[model samples]
Target chain A: MKITDPRTAATGHRVSLAVSLWLSLSVLLALVLISIAVGKYRIGPGELVTALINRLQGGDGEVPTVIETVIFQIRLPRITAAVLVGAALAAAGATYQSLFRNPLASPDILGVSAGAGLGAAAGIFLSLPVAGIQLLAFAFGSFTVLLVYVISRAVRGHDPVLVLVLAGVVMGTLAGSCISLLKYLADPYDQLPAITFWLLGSLNAVNPADMQVSLLLVGLGLVPLYLLRWRMNLMSLGDEEARALGVNAGRLRLVFIMSATLVTASAVSISGVIGWVGLMIPHIARLLVGPDFARLLPTSMLLGAAYLLGVDDLARTIGEVEIPLGILTAFLGAPFFLWLLAHSRRGWQ
Target chain B: MSIDIAGLAFGYPGHPVGSDVSLSVAPGEVLCLLGPNGSGKTTLFKTTLGLLPPLKGRIAVDGETTERWSRRRTAQHLAYVPQQHDAYFPFTVMEVVLMGRGAYVAAFATPGRHDREVAERTLRELHLLHLRDQVYSQISSGERQLTLIARALTQQPRVLIMDEPTANLDFGNQVLVLNQILRLKQAGITIMMSTHDPGQAFYCADNVAMLRDGRLLCWGPTDEVLTSANLRSVYGVDVAVVEITKTGEHPGKVCVPVMSDPRGRADSEIQAPPA
Candidate 1:
């Protein structure tokens, strides 16, 4: 067998990484444009571009009012929400996987999604406003992870990662049961349907305000992760080895967990419990680019944004009634993930 | 740099693996720790590397007590090469070596050009530059061990603590790794290593410390400390320490295990010819 020189191979790898990054970014851009143009109203590409330009240049009334409303008010916000939620979930998944050193780890491994579901279900059962329900969901999601951290800390003398994961499983189960109870008690006439829809997840009701709030929270979470991205590579090497390499593994893990939870909670708050994107997108990204966290973060985010936006487009265009996002993601994500598993030459580990 | 361990008691919480361990390694010297499995050799190495806090002792590096030193400070002075194990990701060899610059790199920043230069230089010195782009998980175990040593060297550490550097390697690879240790010692870096093979200690170690059942059995110069009696006591088997005086080769000692049956009868014992 012949081996290539490292210098040449490294250069080649760098070129490939750059190409992959640009390719994914371009795909996401194309998807975003397609999503904006292909809604129920079916605005033509020329009209879509004209409407966007007119809106950007301060609305000169050249475009039709209905076109403007559909493009700006409905499709734009939904597209933005899908992108943000997908990126946040994927980033969180990559973070959790690296932190736990397990390929199976995802954003929901720490009970954030279950807690958010329970909170949203309660809010709907009590007939709370949309904003109030989202707020409660975010709070519950963050609090569940905090509780798990505390529980893991209180239990002394064990692998901290193992303990945290075990605690998360226990708490997640409890939260899931509570959500089930809430569902059972809800009036089947109205509240139960609302609860079910929220749990199944959708981008149907997202507005500009919800988009802005999620954008702010997800951006806040990503800044820290982006800045500390290189350290995450050390983190995957295990706590003792990372410590030996001069990283305060315990402190770094806390920061990463908190940032990931923050983004996941905020995304779940706006979009309900959209699953599988977090679990699947990072794996896809890992296959595209090798598992250096610094490179993995951006690649995962871009692919995630493109993937969810594409899936959301399918959900809206495939039928009269919009398909729930959670169902579609599982539908699309599972077989694709299995295919990836079967076809992948270099395993994630 | 010199490492001074005084009355060290080390282990996990609620589980004391070893206690009352005291030893020191002078600058540019190699100290070999010989012990059986479950005899707390790893625990001792972890404690010295500051991965585990000492339960009832003080570890000083160059006369400074290290109990309060941050992990970064400890890493700046001491580097540890853990046993070769499976990694969670397929990071390239260069990336793994670059991780050693973590002590010098700021918390928020990635490795800079200088760090890369250092990593490359270490890899080059170890004859590993050719494999720098290979996935770490795809490499052979011997190469993985060498890459780990290259990583430790990248730390620019004063003292290197290696836990069984030659463990799980074949004969040729073991000698290759031992030669690297000797080269590192010649470069004036203090080294402390643990091993299951007494022949390895005779090969490269300047001094030897034997531990059995959580206690230091003996500590002295390698020739005096690694005697047949000490090896027998530590491993519960009889062994002969023989000196080889082959032509055109440097003289050295090698330990040969004396075969015996379960009934305590010598089955194929070979008597050492009169030296």
Candidate 2:
């Protein structure tokens, strides 16, 4: 009867987890199905289902070519890319916030995005192929994080987290300057547009191959993060307390940083530099399901996937030309952030 | 399990904090470390808990060298209650307590049913079962301290180390925590805690160790080691050890600091009470 009864508290967590999971998963599935029908020529739900069924059944070439092209080619890869990028960034953001004990921390706090941006810029300037550019971007992003880790480890004074953040900022600045130099040297008519588009972050050109690769990397990174979900709660208590509770804070931190960077790099390689999804989605998920990582992880993943998919749909249909995902995310995210600030007392734990 | 330290030296790199500290706490014994601020009490506690590697000499838990033991093994034998518990996330009291089962659980596995039962029983034993669902950050300082203690109890350790458990607590909470310590001692849990109050040493300690400027002033039974001379030498003050006898209670020893030195009057200007 009483709240403090162990049975009540235990079930309270389980119930909230189950309820939020089902609700978010339902919303996510509905959004995915609805988004498939929301392009320039909107397809009805029934038509969309029929097209999917025909495709699955080894089409006898009876399906309309326009319908087949639009559903399978135009929308499927873009929608899948949106969901993967959103989920990856959101999961990475949650891990960073917990690992650093700072709510302000994001996926890019370790300079993965900046390094990836530089790698993309240099790849474009060097005139690398598409696959080569993505590969280079991932490598540079991971390399930058490794350098930051090593520098922070070598430093003797200051808190470890502070040092890591400082190193990231310094490395980020260096990488940013290099990117600017590449832009200055690039041909304004040809390479400049490509660089700008990539930096602004868009899903306009995502293909099946890119989606498959990014999804594989994102899924690989999520395994460790999911397995370490319970320990992630301990990370928020700061290193000393975490260590006192029998955790090797240093090792766990390294594991989390590597996992988060892996997913963030993979996402950026596919979708350029979509921001705010990482920062805003976790906070929103925290509001819905409290801050326990066991519940927060899945909730954030689903909410992020749905939120970005909706935003992408709006980007393509809002006006004549497609708006960049980075721009729309900021426009939507800033207002939501203000609302969060106004209602932070709801539950900021 | 008991803690054994012999000729231990603890400090940061190029900064030696304390040395030659030799002491031991038997099973079921409570050892109160008394010292002024910055006297290396925290450093000693960290060394004993195996957080800081001893600069010299050997430290052991139950006669096993700490260096040979894994962090998890050391945690299994000992638990630490820090001076402050601050977490940014809003974990429930039950969740915070459940973290004590971390060492027992495998790296990739979550805590199981038995682990949760142990956590719940520990919370109930510490009278925190009623507050299990409350947010840890929303709880009072006293409740947070008790929650941390319950967490340590969940570890099922042989020795518990507390760093200033009563620091910042009000009168009632202070007494409440002291009684908890006594109860734990009765249940055969060895405790080693540091405190700023010498009187607290008299109340809960079976033995006492006093440190001043990285050196031990005295170490022995509480009554023999916490006398006026040793107290004055360790704290640089005049203190009288007095026994207060109640009508139907055991006599209790208290350290009364004598602050009547005339030199202290020059800056003793008093403010008049409001009308």
Candidate 3:
């Protein structure tokens, strides 16, 4: 029997995917350049390149000191943090979504963000320095997921994923309550505002040190995900099917949760509790590239980086006062996400 | 390859669903498991696939104990096709089939060109190459089941364990899947599948195992095991195992339910149709 071949349709899909990837990459590159050039201390493209070249060539002192500092010290670190945090969160979100087999699963679904928020709040209440606060956030974030994992493991004869998610929800709520308690007890004039702002999230305070540390942690997390990208496809099929397909699903899940949590914690540590990017970017990427993790991961990272950088740029330049990134992301992301949901012909399943 | 299950007890930890169950499927033979809901057929299949630890006995593949084998090694010998269900992502048929090559692909690597070739060839064999680019979720239920079968086939396993492959399918699709099962059997692949319908067992199963309440009711060659008495015993409903020997067609068996009054009244108490 002859079947009508849709080979041409398939080829069209392949071509579209390729085009989408290239378009995302180009957008990201353009956003990076725009982010570098359009800051308050507006440096022209020529001056920016010259300053970068001068900095790279052993600080030749040809560029003015103020320009050099703005490019290298302030804007560069903040931009790098934006991209890294964006990519990390999006990657983590995609991982969790796939692992949970739920489109609604986000980077913080496992309580990492809540734990980080609690840790940062505690740090601000204690009047700790920025570095100390970041450290606490990272530590607490990892600890929360570990605690949830242990709790899920302790509960037997239930669906493991459901158990894990439930534990995370419970733990996340507890962490949120703790943060609220901290907020209630803090000195309203100083610590409360600091805690609130930290919770709202910002990249304005990101320094070279924070950028480097997060970069390292995010890279560490992403390597395992990249290596096991193919296997990640089977993970959504659930533990039983994955095992039947020769993947040790339990072990693979552990590896994935740890990796995704590491990236999320690291991103949250430096950037505070930026929301929506993790939850939204992966969906947008899936709409663009379909759900093949090998393609989805990279596409998510690129789009996420571009998205946050663009949002951050707006945060700085859209008004006299810089808006918290969390607010901007929600304000922008929710509507776009809804629009995507309504317009896309593909079902979320 | 052949599979041997000796005194196998299986279930999740702290909950034993079935125990002391034993069965085997020889090379290229089809073994059909017939059971009602919650009778532990799925649990048994999971145990046989090594997804769950056999609580009491052992499962041997090709006469070798598979207790210590890695999941990859187990999958090299066997693959599983789960019931038709919604996939979370809209992966294309080709992508889903390519995932079956996970056992052969390196942990740190994606499926290579050769893996794609195997997936494509499996799809071709199943006549599913035409739907290769179609999203798995968008396909008809029968096509989804076939796609899953193609995935299992791409694993290049000698044995395939399917959990109710015909469940939820319409009549034509059910026959299509059954015909595919027979085709696979003819291709010398061992298949162990569970079915809600005993007639399905009659259709393709060389051997049959009837399960109820976590225990085997009867098991042997299909004709010997799937009698009307066995069906009534297992399902608590009377059914006549009828043979149809239509001319110019292969003889087949079908289970026709013998309905009774729902009020527990004897047939004689009901007003009979005017003679």
Candidate 4:
């Protein structure tokens, strides 16, 4: 009866979450629209807003055809890609935390993003087109998770922790080596630039077609986990307890592994292996709200989208040359993760 | 609610830890499975709960074979509280308890209003209502044990199976867990547990199953099965079974040898010499 009371949290918790969610989403929304306005062509907020309005309503579209093309064709796709990628990364991170029952678990740290990058690089070195590169990335990303699961299964009985982490580092290093090999083998004229750009990770390459792929991949993969959210929450308690609760750990883990990597691979394929969004966003979500999975997963999705949008804007606007989204996210995310680590230390102790 | 194990065997691929272990449990009964380290108490619990498929034998809960049921369905019928869990993230007590409702909802759906009420009532029953908001891992070991039990209670199972549920707690906490279990038994819940503590076997258990060398040495009423002779044989040591004045009927004190010194193996009663 007490739990059914809508106000589970006191006034303070409700107020803080409401304020934070509103503030974060609003700031993120503003930055996205404004970033759409100020590109290499340098349109102001008014022109950007008018163009977006017209594009939605239909007509001369708003600005000149070229300007409209720049906004609609180029900048819009990139900004949308950033938000989707961010949301996917954060959602994947939260899923990983439940998968491994460790907050430190993330797509990159577990080597999935690395494997995806390696796959993309392989595609590039082989001179495959962009669509082919996306395929390669998803394939490699999925393979990495399977191998981790296999190795963890092999070394059963010992805590799944050490074996899993070891497998990630070993596989990640192997994937990194493959990336190095691709970089070395690439033709300097045509192939090298593509491989290099893929490694750096950018929204500069994303367009409507890529956005469509992003939507398809992330949408399908996310639905299962979202529907299975309560099961995932039960699972986070640890394997035996979950089994005791009547969950098939093997099946659930397989579903989560495949699905979480689906989102990661899509994000990786389109945006080229952005880091930290997954790892840090879950921690931040947990701190704001306690670790209730129902609350935590949805909140992580929203905040991750908003946070990545803001970060990508800064990436675009920092200087004459734009910083890679991956580098910018890492720059911001790693410290927040560390700060959380320090804060969690006292509470756990 | 009751359990029927025709024959149960468990172990790794090459190394079978237990075999031909037959047992049963009836409602309002506390059954304690006792064995030394590596004798297969934990393994038996896993097999019974269907976490690990038994290498041999059949386990039936409420007259139906375990293999017949879905994991969720089986989980709804029986609940287990494990030895000691150390999760890196300290989900709150309510959050932990709410996990017991895993079987009541559609896979992946949030626990509905009724599920939450069950969890709350379970926690309240365990005297953990005030502590529900506290992080589980941050709680004292005694409280953690109680919280885990509360979580199991929320499953609304007819039978409760636990593996050394009070292992990490101190003496006072041990009493609390045992007392709570007794109350659950009074409510007609069938109880099964594996514990190394002999005092617990006689003090609270209605039936005792002693395991040795992957075999069921005995399974019957507590007084008949957990004799000083049985303890000596299984553990390869001497034991002094002392009757407590508080409960004259049940043997409450069991003094076991430190390292199983075979030097003083008296024929009839193998026990601590003089002292």
Candidate 5:
């Protein structure tokens, strides 16, 4: 007999729910504060806080030029971009896991991320503006998952698990080849650097406009899920069982995939294809508070925001030159992946 | 609305599991299908649910063939609890049960207040109210069965089909699942289950359907079809159809052990003291 309280089975109690929530929020807040503190130009801690306070107050007439530049122009946009991208990735991860009913399933399981990365790179090599690249990334990323869904439905398996995953792999490879072709055709010095930077992933180019478009659509996609978290909970059961209970498995899956894709595409648009956050964030979230989606969604959002922000911080300041955020995440995240693979009784589900 | 099974045959691609089966479940009645291993019991249930297409005949719910109604509409009137559910995701017990409202909810619409309440009540009925928040993967076998039943209850279905609902449960949980079925029957739900255990079926089932070699051997009131003679023919084995004969202070169980005697084994084991 399945029980509701996760604490009673295999893990700690619901009380840990509160602790996880608090920990996520505190880490997110700390990351935000730390992110606000660092940049190409550093502002004194007190002055930074003062500038932030002044900026928020809209009375920043006499602020020091150094503090003003750091807070208003450089740090504010990057920090906002980091938090939003992280939250979106983590939320997309949780959504993908639920939609596919596999713990090892990630947003890229349906080739969405890879498709978007290829689109962004192609846009850059073709001399599309930064905004056009963002748009292309969002469109192609969402399109990849949609294509996977349609093909899987038409293909051999009615169950979209392995079919979609395999379809994703195929599409991802095709997109990757297209990206290679674009690289071969590019002006070596200019477009090669552009495509390479886009591939490695960075937060250097995210602006308020990209963030705004993503925030609006991605937030809309997430709200319905948050409100219908209980339904998402039902969706985790096998379709046969779930339908016997009354869930329309096909319709709900479509909704879930589209919604997850929306957020994932948006995140990709802003972050330029950070690899591991979406794959790993929800797993850590599950480890923290179990899988009740109401708790799980919020926990992922918080941890994802915190984690990505922290990783970006290290990426920006750890060396004299900026390293791509994806490299930093892969460094910290791949070992966790290998550990999860080695120890988790069921690996890469 | 009774479930009418008329001359139905079903099986996998290369194996002909069962055929020429006819049965019905009256409103508020419990029907038990008894069969040995490889008896096509699961296939019969699947055909009725329209999960697998029947090769020979038809299954009707409320006097109409299953094909006449939309799956959702048919599903609204009936629910099934699978023999086992290891194929689920990491959803919660409450969430699992709440999926019973799937057909009722509009496309892309969330579950409303009534749906949540129904799920909660279903959990309460299964004595799983305390387990509503638990993740699905970590639950015990018995609890898993109850959770499935709770999901069925959330459907508010009129006909309930279960395939070996007690296969994983111990004796206590077997009783527990049957008790829930009995409760569903009393609420005017027609219940059908393929069970291997005869003793449990004798008490709970209004009718018993027996299958062998893809054919219905016999089906009728439980007492009529569950006789020792019929049991022997169906199973082709020696079995004691025990009976109670109470006499004063010393009660006796009249052990009717099978007598496949070479001679008239009246004194068969009586004179043999050592093996």
Candidate 6:
């Protein structure tokens, strides 16, 4: 009965969820709007808002053609793609970290990213079209996780999570070798640059069609995660505890792996392998709002969206030529990650 | 409801660790299981909790077969506290305790206000209400064990099964946990726990079961099953059950192992024949 009387530091366990959610959402909105305004064509905030309102009302005739094209055709697809990719990777990463009960577990827990990279590099070496390359990446990514799942299943009665991680490591090394082989075989003049660029990851080639496809797939993947968020928390406590708590740990783990894999594969297919969002955003969200998955999932998604959008904005606006997303993210993420490790004692609670 | 396990066999795949195990605990009774390392005490506990299927026999809970019961229903009847747990995420103590309400909560639903109330009450009952706000991982092992007990209590189960609940604890903390087990027995919870110390059986167990190499060696009232001979037979160590009497305190049994040599002896003395 006297529970609420505690004003101690331990009792201040979490930031108020509603307030954090609202603030993150507001910041995400502001980032999207501001990012649209800051691009090369220089659409002002006022013009952008008016054009958005006009477009929402289906009065496209009032807005100038260039402004309309810049907003809808150029920036909108890129911004939407960035947000979706960021949110998907972060959500999948958080789920992976929880599922494996390893803080080091990333979205590539099943070698999906390595498989995608290998597939994309091979596609580039063979001079495939952009769409063909993306298709190959998606196919290989999903296939790799499926193979990992199959291998883990083959070795029954052992800890499935441990088996999956081991399979992932072995398969990831295999995929990395394939990538190196492809790189070595690629033409030094044209194909090598393309292969390198794709591996480094780019949003420049992401169009409206790619955005639509990824949006649908990421949304589909996210629904089950949102529904099973609390179970994800339970699963993170390890298999025995989760089962003791009345959950079917194996079935739930399979469901989560498939869902997370779908999103990661779709995002990689579109954005080429943008790293760090999946590995770091959940930790940031955990620092903001404890480890309860119900709150952690949404918070990770919002923060990831904003963080990626801001990073992408800098990628496009900082120079004459566009920088790839992967490099910028690693540049920013690695140092921040180190800082997190340094301050971990204060923040983990 | 009391736990009623009969002819239970438990093991991992292709490895039969325990067989022909039979035990029963009545409501308000404390059952202590004594065994050596790898002697199938934990395997039997797991089988009783229905975490593992019995390889040979039937496990019934209050006259109902557990296989016919849903996980949620079984959890409502029986709760388990493992010897140790390492939680990956740093969930607060209260959140960890609230996990015990998972049985009552519907799938896809989070713990509600009523569940929180139960957790709070259980934590308070164990004198852990002040520590509820602390991070679970940051706590001492004794507090962690107590928190786990509080979590089990939140399940409101008729039977509680703990595997070596006092393992790795200081003497004071071991007594603390043992006292809590006694208190739980008084509160009408059917309690079963495993321990290496026979003295604990004498202290708290109403019934005792000794296991050795997948077989139930002895089972009966604590005083009957936990004699010096049974201890030596199960543990391969000679021990004496000595009585302790103190002023204004209840008399208790203390198990003292008979060690021939306190320090390591030279090979010559060790081989110095029957003398």
Among the numbered candidates, top DockQ falls to: 1
Q: What ordering of candidates by lDDT runs from best to worst?
A: 1, 3, 2, 6, 4, 5
Residue A134 local lDDT, model 2: 91
Clash count, candidate 3: 0
The true-versus-predicted C-alpha distance at residue B260 of model 4, in Å, is 11
Question: Who is ahead in lDDT, 1 or 3?
Answer: 1
**Two-way DockQ contest, 1 vs 5, winner:** 1
Using Cα atoms with residue i matched to residue i, what is each candidate's TM-score against the true structure? Answer: 0.97, 0.94, 0.94, 0.88, 0.84, 0.92
Runs of candidate 6 exceeding 4 Å displacement? A1-7, A11-13, A53-57, A60-63, A122-128, A346-349, B262-275
Give per-residue CA lDDT, model 1, range A158-198, as digits (tens).
99999999999999999999999998999999999999999
Name the TM-score of candidate 5.
0.84
What range of 10 consecutive residues in model 1 chain A has the weakest lDDT sum? A6-15
How would you encode candidate 2's per-residue C-alpha lDDT over B1-275 as one tens digit per residue?
78889999997767889999999989899999999999999989888877778899888877878866677887887899999656688788999899998779888888899999999999888888988887787788999999989988888888999999999899898998999999999999999999888899888999999999998889999988988888889999767777778899999977877666476654322322221
Report the lDDT of model 6 for residue B266. Answer: 34
Q: Which candidate number has the best lDDT?
A: 1
Candidate 5 stretches greater than 4 Å from native: A1-11, A16-23, A156-158, A184-187, A338-349, B7-21, B36-39, B50-58, B64-76, B87-139, B183-187, B211-218, B223-275
In candidate 1, position A22 carries an lDDT of 98
Candidate 3 per-residue lDDT, tens place, A303-347, comes to: 899999999999999888899999999999789778877876643
Q: What tens-digit string does per-residue lDDT give for candidate 4 at A1-349?
A: 4455332332223224566577667867777777677756888777767777887787563467877888878888888888898889988999888677777788765678888989999888887888899889988987887787788789866766567768888989999998888888888888888888788788887779878878998999999878888788777877778888978877887788778888888888888978788888887777766566666677788889888878877888777898888788888877776776677564321
Ranking by DockQ: 1, 3, 6, 2, 4, 5
Give the Cα error of residue B138 in candidate 3, in Å: 0.9
Q: Comparing candidate 3 with candidate 4, which one achieves the higher DockQ?
A: 3
Q: Write the per-residue lDDT of candidate 6 for residues A1-349, one digit (tens) a residue.
A: 6566433465375687898889999999999999889978898778988999999898859889899889888888989988888999999998898788887788998999999998898888878898889889998999999999999999988888899999999998899899988888889999888888988888888899877787888889998999888778778878877777777888989899999999999999999889999999999888778888999999999999999999999999998999999999999989988888787774333
